[model samples]
Target: MDASRQIAARIEFLRRQLVDREPGPLRDAYLAVPTRERPVLQGTTTPALTQIWQQRPSGLITPATAETQPIDLIDVYLTFEEIFGFAAGPAYPVKQLQALPLGFVLQFCAELLNALSRPGASHSDVDRAFATQWLKEPIRTRVLNELRDPRRALVVPQALMLLARAAVEHSPDSLPDGAKPGNLIGALLAFSDMIGPSGEGGPTVLGEQPGDLGREVIANQYFNNNASVPHTFARYVRRWRELPQQFAGKDGLVDLPAVYEQCTGVTLDDLTVVAGALWAAACNGNVLTPTAELETLLPAGQVAKVLALISADLETLRQAVQSERARRHTEWTFDAFQQRPVIRLGAFLLVMDQRHLIDRAFGWLPILDVRFPPDTHPRPTNHEKLAGQAIRTLRRFSELYVSEVLHSITGQGTTTRRVYDDPELKAAFQGEGQKIADAAVDYGDTWVVVEVTTSQLQRDAATAVPGNAQVKDIDKLLEEVRQIDATIQALRRDESRLTGVSSQIRRRYLPLLLLTEGFPVNPVSMTVIRERAHKRGLLQGQDVMPLEVIDVEELEWIEALQEQQGVSLLAVVQRKQASSLERTSMRSFLADTITTPLSHPQRFEGKVSKALGPLEAVLLKRKQREP
Candidate 1:
């Protein structure tokens, strides 16, 4: 396709990829990235992280425990599970690591060092022939976690020499057995596959020679900078803003960030972010005719903006890029490059942003309709629909589990109206474009308002959040409440979904329940949930109206039991009979134990404003339009 048509196609692709946001300051606000802090467990490094190398279970490829996993697996655990002291993830370049097997790590390290220490020619990362090569597979592979080159720079060779010198001085035994001055040379050759039949590259090899930094080489000291905070992300944000021109000027595609850094002195944590952002911004969107606002900021004004960008906080740059993306929005791209989405510059930026986003994209990005005033641009993930499914399951199963417990206790019959499913109720609550409660339960006369919610925890804690994530504190835990709060307001107006339930109960209590992936085990977390829920208005009558979130695991276990027994709650009640545990009412289980209501003083509130009140007027308009 021609350039104009190509740009149009790209804009369309972006529209499908990114949710729309308000324009101007509001859009800027929504585009900001949130800060994240990762938690780590003690006793994880050393032989523990490299247990796979130290004791590969001849037949077992996976590590025995998370602690004994490879550095790659362990790093993911550190972020996804917060099992290690790692505060955030993508762990930023893996330039340096303490827990990886020395052999595997050394292979890459040696390649990086040799590329750097070469004497004659200045090996630049820019010109592939001179620095490095640029390929689509590299971008795609890196984003998907297949490319493992850490510290994309060739500074390793310089650093390696320093390490070798230290090893020789401190303790000779620490060097590889019978090692010589050329040990680094040998390592470089072996790891780079220089000795192969074709004298070309090959796969990485792992063994004892590359295992430890020699026993004397302190693991922690070898990579003191491993745990240091990464700042390349800020530079990547700056790079993202300058992409359209740079990418277009540099041919159909741009070289990787290491090449950029080698030539321009800028650093890139994840090249994919550079590519992803480029796509989200210029190539993926219709920027052929700059927005009127962008036109005004060009040439004369653009220079100042660029200058301001240099010192601009990470959040500011992020908001600017996001705002630009929205301004350039048009339609989805119908064009393809080898069946892959193409933007001369877009592909590169999209790749970079995808690699970066799971760690630093805009915070708590709810899918299209579930948006609120306080946040925008929820991090894109493969888990959105799954999160919804999980919540639905928990709501249904939790209702059944609690209802069964109640029946065994009071001997009073309980009924559940899958009310939202009833045709009459659907008409009442969802006329044309409306939403309703996920599920409902009626325990004798006391009807409970159960609101089931599940938000995807950070798919990539390090780069998933958006904006200048440096300043924006995007707490996954905080996001849980933010999501709950967004859906909670519906409850105040959602009673209509239950019009099918012919209940003449004089008294009704709202037992608001929220559910998300994973169990809340931390007392502090429980406190935050309680406090945040109350602050958002779930804080009404503490005793009578129990407001608690569900522990997905607990309900999941109960869900499994029902499947195994191949019977409904009634049959299980009949078989087990009424024991003391059975006597424990579902109300007590939900209101008293399972949930942490608002009255409890565990107020862990973050500085976030309430979301816009439920779009009542919008819903009303839709209802009016319906027959």
Candidate 2:
């Protein structure tokens, strides 16, 4: 058999033996082998290993437990899901593979790793080993080539920004009536309400219900709670709500209340209440109930409307599954489920018969649609046009957002000024036909030059077989970096002209590049940028600080740490620079360097509340108007 077929055969054997059977015996058998004898359990400090062996079989993999693995085992499963299982046929039953206990999965993987270490093992011995060994080389190559490379992270942010802007720009006059952008947001909020921690003594959907093991598996595996949905919605409402009014002039304002009423057959206020009510009911162990249960909470018509907005029939889901399979075949890096048909139809709601409930369910993958919006229109051309417009809006928004974050970090006493607003600084660069940096902040003794870019990874670069696509994308980024380096060079050269300071003045200049999305700042990308910058003599002087690249998320995280915990931004940056030459993401760097008192969700929600307060007041008034 060929490598692919061989890999699939091994996976099928393991699935039959490990997944389709009761895991208790296997667990006991594996544990019975003394800890010293079980090489898989050796040298791992993860507490989960001990807990899993001691505790009763839970049959569910919690998010915390899943993270303890040495490698991203989820990705390993997804690789097979996309490449072999879905692409080939239902014979693979890839979704069922995820339902295997985390302990078993880890143990199996560990044993495979241990077996691979043994010298001169027979082909039959290797074949009898777990499937991970057969696909190890491909998995390893893919992980190194694509998975670990953070360039793919750029796609989701860009797609989300575009989708969001399209939603804001979507007009009521459009053909083929569909869910309004606000309705989509409402559905997302409802979905978030469903999955978020239940009220004390309230009905719980995730851990308490029968067949909830499957639900928890779906939630933990797919919708890992890196971001809070309500906070994300708040940010969206606060930011995009202003776009229509600002960009479209006096007549540009979208009446969101009217939009929601028209599309969802209920006012925004009613939708919110009904959505909450529905969440409570769904969580009350009614996963198998008909529409009647939902109707009891709201008007029949309204219930149908909400259901139509959020849920998809089995046929729709089947089609989406197929489309997703096709999408993976085409664009290997395109993993954002929001853009896929399945998530676009609705993420939280999946209509399956009682016989095909969570136990026999086809992995009810629930994507966080709030962070990643579905397509705004049916037509591809219209979607493209809106995406193009969103790019421009994103550019402007990124600059303002970065500026605001910097100003907040610098605080009230700091001198922060936009370079474009300063005539001298603008003119100084205009002579060389160059654009000035976005903003400048006088934080402590250092002069910080801020540059913001919404430049994203092109779709072609993310395709399955990117020929010249990757090269072209890298070239664009290098050019952007070079331009920023040139701008810094000019700023230093014309220091006396613009700031009335001598070139010999021992002034420290820190250049900060704020990306709207995350980019790979791995050794390769960083080395390339550094080498080019060094060749341009941008890093020659001791006065010039190394150019630090931080995405918007990291910037927000830093700002939160500074504001909430009194952490110093300058100190963080200096420490980061001093610590490593081969840079990782700023977020990862922050995680390693500082531990904040507030969790990410708390910090993010606090940040969003500042912007969402006014909007909430309006929403409150609308709610009060409800009888």
Q: What are the TM-scores, per candidate, against the unseen true structure? A: 0.26, 0.49
lDDT of 2 by residue, 213-296 (tens): 222222232222132233343334333444434544333233333333433344434434343333322334332334554454
lDDT accuracy of residue 98 in candidate 1: 22
lDDT of 1 by residue, 1-627 (tens): 899999999986654333243333333343322222222222111121223323332223443442321222111100111112233222222222322223333333333433332222233331133222322444334323421332122222323323322222222223344543333322322222211122122223322111111111112212211110112222222222223234432322333333323322223322232322222343232222212322222333432222221212223323443443433211111111101111122111111111112222211111111211112223224334434432343333333334333333223223432222223334555555444344344444434444444443221211112221211222334443443333334334454445534444443444434342222222222343455555656435432343344443333332333343333333333222232222222222322222322221111011111011112333344468678
Question: Clash number for model 2?
Answer: 0
Candidate 2, lDDT over the whole model: 0.42
* Residue 480's lDDT in candidate 2: 60
Query: Which residue ranges in model 2 land beyond 4 Å of their true spot?
Result: 1-234, 242-312, 324-336, 340-391, 412-428, 459-471, 496-504, 528-543, 564-567, 596-627
Cα-based lDDT at residue 562, candidate 2: 68
Which residue pairs clash in candidate 2? none
Model 2 TM-score is: 0.49
Model 1 CA lDDT for position 125:
39
